[model samples]
Target chain A: SQQGEEDPQALSIQEGENATMNCSYKTSINNLQWYRQNSGRGLVHLILIRSNEREKHSGRLRVTLDTSKKSSSLLITASRAADTASYFCATAAATDSWGKLQFGAGTQVVVTP
Target chain B: EPEVTQTPSHQVTQMGQEVILRCVPISNHLYFYWYRQILGQKVEFLVSFYNNEISEKSEIFDDQFSVERPDGSNFTLKIRSTKLEDSAMYFCASKWETQYFGPGTRLLVL
Candidate 1:
C-alpha cells in the first residue's frame, strides 16, 4: 500500500488564482517533500518541510505540514500556465533507513491562461 | 545548477529481452536510487544504493532487477528477461540529503 495519498485527484485553475492540494500519509515521518512533473517528464523537486516545521515558503510556493493530522498541503500562489503539472507528495519515515521515500498518488494541476 | 542525466530517453524492447537504463548523477552526490511510474500511477521506489552497494529495495524490485555503478559517474539498472508489466518511465535520482531526479527513460516492453 502507498504511504501517502493526495486529495483532489485533479485541479484546474485560472492564471493568477491560487491552487491548493492536500496530502495525507499513514505513518510518522522524518519529513515530507513536494515534487512537480510536467506531462511525460521527470519529477522536479519543489520544497521539503521537516516533521518539526509547520510551514515553509519558496518563491510562490508554500507548504504546510501537520504531523498531528498526518497530512500536508501545497499551495501555489499566483499560478501560471507553466505550473500545470502533476504534484506529488513524498514521505520520508522515521523507520526508513537510507532515506527512501514513499510517494502519494499525486494531484494533477492544470492552470489555464 | 547541476542535475542528474539519463541516457536513451526512450527504449522499446520485446517482452523477453533484457534492457538497461543508465543515469549519470550529480558529480558530488553520494546516494543513488531508481524509481518507476506506470502511466497514471504514482512514482514507485525500486531501489537505493550507497557505498557501492544496495542499501534498500522495495518488493517491486525482484530477482530480475539489478543495479550497478560501473564507474565513478554512471549508475545503471538492468532488467533481465523483461515482462510486459515493466513498461514505464524509469527515473534515476541522486542525493546527498535532498534527491534530484533525472529526466527519465521511458521503456516500452511490447
Candidate 2:
C-alpha cells in the first residue's frame, strides 16, 4: 500500500522564522494535499499539488512535489503563533477514482511567540 | 463557502454498545468520505461513499461497521459493537475537485 511518511516528527521555531517539513511516499499519486490540525481539532485544508506540477504556493504556504523521488515538501514562511498545529501530508492515488487519501503521521509544528 | 458538518460533537458510549455518527456533506458535493484519528495518532481512512453507495473502504472498516445515506442530506456511520479501541475523532469530508472536511465527532468508547 502507498504510505506517506513525514520527517522530523516534531519541530519548534520562533515566530517569523520559516519551517519546512518533508514527506516521502511509496507509490505514484495523482495529487498530494497538505492539511493542518489544531490540537484535538478538525483538519483544515491548506494546499494541493498535482503530480505534474513541481511547485505551488498559497499565501504563506509553499509546496513542492518531486514525483521522480516520490517525495514532497511544505514550507511555511514567516510563521506565526497561530500556525502552531500538526501538519499532515495526504496523497490521492492515481488509480483511485473515489478520492481516498492516504495520510502521513504528520509533523507537529510549534511556533513560539 | 460551504463546509461539511457532523453531529454529536462528542459521544461517550460503553463498550459493546452500538453508536451512530452522522454527517452532512457540502450541499453540492458528489463524493463523501469518513476518517478517524486515534488520540496522538495519524488519521486513517474508514470509508468513502458516492452515489448513495460505498465506493471504497479501508481494512479498518470491518463487518461491524457500516455506512448509510438514508436521506439526501445526511450520511451516517454505524458501529454495531464498539470496542475500547474504537475511540477516536471521526471526520466527514465532501469532495469536489478537492475535499472539505467537517469539524469531526469525538467518540469515546469506555
Candidate 3:
C-alpha cells in the first residue's frame, strides 16, 4: 500500500510562476525524498529531507517537512517549461527493515511557456 | 557522475515465454531495486536486492518474478512465464540512501 498521498493530481502554471505540490504520509519516516519523471522515462532524484530536518533548498527548489503534521511540500520557484513533469514523494519508513520506499500518487505539473 | 543503465529499451514477447530485463547499476552502489509502471500509473516497487540477495518484495512480485545480481555490475529481472497483464516499463535502481534510476526497459507481453 502507498504510504503517501499527493494533492492536486495535476497543476498548470506559467513558466515564471512558482509551483507548489503537497504530500501527506501516514507513518513515521526516516526520510522523505522527491523525484521528477519526464514522460515515461526514469525518475531523477531531486532532494531528500531527513526526519530531523524542517526545511532544505537546492537551486530553485525548496522543500519543507512538518513531522508533527506528517506532511511535506515541494516548491519550485521561477518554474520553467522544462520543469514540466511528474513529481513524486517517496517515504522511507522508520520501521522499514530495508531501505524500501512507499511512493505517493504523483503530481503532474505543467509549466507553460 | 555515474548512472544506472538498462538494455533493450523495449521488448516484445508472447505469453508464457521467458524474458529477462537487464540493468547495470552504478559501479560502487551496494543496493539494487526493480520497479515498474503501467501506462499512466504511479511507479510501483517490485523488489530490492542487497549483498546479492533479495531483501524485500511487494505483493505484485510473485512466483513469476525473480531478480539476480549475477556479477558485480549486472542486475536482472526474469519473468518465468510472461502474462499480457505484465506489459509495463521496468526500471532498475541502485543506491545506499539515495537511489539513481535507469532509463528503463519497456516490456510488452503479447
Output the lDDT of residue A55, model 3. 100
The docking category that best describes candidate 1 is high
DockQ of each: 0.91, 0.95, 0.78
Candidate 2 lDDT: 0.95
Residue pairs clashing, model 1? none
**Interface RMSD for candidates 1 onward, in order:** 0.6, 0.5, 1.0
In lDDT terms, how accurate is model 3? 0.92
Residue runs of model 3 more than 4 Å from their true location after superposition? none
Second chain TM-score for model 3: 0.98
Clashing pairs in 3: none
Cα deviation at B10, candidate 3, in Å, is: 0.8
Best by lDDT: 2
**TM-score of A-chain in each prediction?**
0.97, 0.98, 0.97
- Please give the range of 10 consecutive residues that has the lowest summed lDDT in model 1 chain B: B92-101
lDDT per residue (tens digit) for residues A30-107 in model 3: 999999999988889999999999999999999999999999999999999999999999998998767788888899
